[model samples]
Target: MDYTATLNSMGQGLCYALVSILFIFLAKKLDDWRTKNFDDDRHIDDGNLAVGLRRAGLYLGIAIGMIGALSGESAGFRTDMLYLLVDGVLITGCLFFSRFINDFVMMGNMNNDRECVKVFILGDGRTVTGNTALGTVEAGMYIATGFILNGSMSGSGGSFVQSLGSALLFFVLGQFVLLGFGLVYEMITPFNLRDEIKQNNPAAGIALAGILIALGIILKASLSGPFTGWVNDIVGFFVYTLFGMILLIGFNALVDRFLLPTTNIATEIKEDKNVAAMVLVQATIIAVALIIAHAI
Candidate 1:
């Protein structure tokens, strides 16, 4: 390799190491926080440790698989497959280390005198807090993966360091984008479908389905051509599809609860009008945000 290429590879490796260290530290801190505040069960339980490790492994495998696919050269399908296998194993190994540390901290801090707290694993408006430590770990992995993928594309020669840095940047950017989309969706289309289900509102369900379909269409459109090509160039199309699905579900729930009400015709009509306006506003915001981000 040329001098510049050598330097680029070295830099990428360093970046990967730094990214790994950062995530490991984050996982450890999260574990500490969880043990101090959340896990009241005094005795260290293997079950929680196992669960956390499994979750980490699963996410790591996914990230690696994704990266491998994205890194494939067109010359040989076999080469692509090998790349996926190797990278997936490497990434998964790193994830395992992070999980091990997380588990140690959590289990070590368990106190026998305290009762274990039940935490919410999913959903909004939940009373109990979920495993924030695990969440942080997962998020860290995603960020790391995004950084690595982007770095590789930027002529960094797929060095671990460069990829990790690029993945981290993408993770931050993705979070902001998701947050903006979420808030805009909420403000424009607030409806409670849970309440509707309790009251058996057929129209509410229909409205929810419609909203989901519309959002799906918009996502498909946004991912067309150059935008999709660029995203695929880095993280691959699968990740984008997965992300789009997540957003779809979240948006659907918001519409069901906030936009559609199980009430009189007059109220429903009023709500529908609001929902239409909200949909327009959300669509516009999402389009604008995507355009701006892509341009940048």
Candidate 2:
């Protein structure tokens, strides 16, 4: 309706566009340096879909991390730009290095970086390319942590240093829950969780990735908004995650009963490697998580 206002918006959009390009480029160059014993760009050039997905996820993660800084309370165009650039660089540095922590912690004994880029030779004169399972899971880690960081970097209650402390604390807390959830999930599920993922079973990996992403969404809610004392907030986070975990497990149970009463989901996924079934599982998990997140 207002031509002058529209023109100003367009001008600002162009600035954001340029910054976005530069931010992503900077993240890629940082990845090149941070990734150890692995060459993501070379593998991507060699047509590895797994590597491509991981790299894509990293970019998307960077964007998500920037969203809070971009949209939060603005001090003016210049201040907003300052926050955007600062947050972009911070997100890149944190997430790039966090990849190593995730590879070691959440992945257990498996080396995800190596797994994604490793070549395989089969006994029947056939070669398996890359491990899509590890790739997808690693991507999930990036995207999920992005949401977590977004929450940490949000709100107007604390100083920047304090926010950093809260972010680090939340990140560590999220990791412990994730690790515990994996163990609990393994105990309840019929299939060998680690074995399936290690074997490059796409279905298993998808399920695991779905859980992590869903957990991230739910945790983001806990970390959002103003600080209400550290003890209360941390307790609230644990409570929210506890409820979310129950719902995640219960939803899977319901799916087993109502969705696939005759067929065992474990069998379909582990034995048959039914990606469709896993897709259903993944969708259900995220759908439940979304509901829980909004309700919280």
Number of the predicted model whose lDDT against the real structure is largest: 2
State the lDDT of candidate 2 residue by residue for 192-252, as single tens digits. Answer: 8878877778788888888888888888877787877789878988998898788888887
Q: lDDT (CA) for every model shown?
A: 0.39, 0.78
- For model 2, the superposed segments whose C-alpha errors exceed 4 Å read 35-39, 121-125
TM-score list, all predictions: 0.30, 0.89
TM-score of 2: 0.89
**How big is the positional error of residue 231 in model 1, measured in Å on the Cα after superposition?**
13
Q: For this target, which candidate reaches the highest TM-score against the unseen true structure?
A: 2
lDDT of 1 at 251: 50
Report the error of model 1 at residue 124, Å.
Answer: 20
**Which residue runs of candidate 1 sit more than 4 Å off their true CA positions?**
1-33, 40-162, 192-296
Model 1 weakest 10-residue run by lDDT: 106-115
